[model samples]
Target: MTRGLTPSVHAIWQAMGLVPPPGPLGARHDFTIEDTDLILRLAPDGQAATLEGTLGALTPDPHEATAQLRKLLRLGLGLAGFNRAALVLPDVNGADAAGAAALMALADRRPDQPPLRVTAQARIAPGDPRAAVAALEDILQWRSFARDVIPASAEPATAAAHPASPATPPDSGADFVIFQP
Candidate 1:
């Protein structure tokens, strides 16, 4: 409904090897899933999947483009007859090494299904904890809706429960507890 966005995502799904590549009407080029009049081009300025309108190489502002992408995906829920779906935020383009590795691990180990993946890394040093938290929150909200609305599958928490190595004990200091997700 939003700028013919659903099929665009489908195009991306195809491009990612999550779904088979589209026929003559679709093909991969540059970084986007291309079709006539529309494109699900990977966002170049920031994160990926920042869907935008293209006209002779002109692109909308980054924030606006991101909003449009969200709108388009929401439209898919009703039109695609999918009430619930898992989102897998691929650890592609945006994420750093740790975040990317974690997501890749999740994808590799989890069942094959549509789960949104956000590549934001929270715990990685030099990373913004807030951004990581925001990404985590987004994943939770979507998952709640999906469980209530649609039948789907997901990967188990790969990094959530794993224990980190013990920090070096301070000399003559009391024991401290470390928490992990």
Candidate 2:
């Protein structure tokens, strides 16, 4: 088993049967999984890494955007088996942004189009190369689900039409059930 050493993103890439980008192992790299573009940045200490990519954008309508934002937040909180990833919306200045202040800025600035860009990030632990690959795959899966499955507007009737599924298996002995839409 791999241990003690910092996880190598190149190793993870090769393990996933993809060619590593031409660069030093520690450098940030951009790659694609299932046609979804992703950026990988390793921590300075090499103890961890982050995989981030844009999933989509929030709806232009205020009410719809609010609802969409809430759902994205819930997904980031690990709701609906999407715990492997977190959603982020960077501000105009490109700083990590969230909550009301960011929302207000997004609203005030870009009224004609979807102002808030949604990104999904997943943390990769050190040591095991498989873990990093898994994290990348998980984020890609969740990205696809978010873009295809999640509705732009959360209508009561539309929400009720699709029931949620349990995140865990029934006989797993877990006490709680996480329902994903």
RMSD of 2: 15.8
Highest TM-score among the candidates is held by which one? 2
Candidate 1 structure quality by residue, lDDT tens digits, 1-181: 2222234444445444576344432222222223112223323332323222211110122333234335435644543343222333334676655445444444454423322323111111112223322323333344344333332232322223444644665575777789999
lDDT score, candidate 2 = 0.62
Candidate 2 on 34-151: residue-level lDDT in tens?
Answer: 6466777775575677788767666555566677777777666664464577776665453544434556754665445434656778877766667777777777766766765343
TM agreement with the true structure for every prediction: 0.20, 0.61
Candidate 2 lDDT score at position 110: 42
Query: Once superposed on the true structure, which residue ranges of model 2 sit more than 4 Å away at CA?
Result: 1-7, 44-46, 77-82, 91-102, 106-114, 149-181
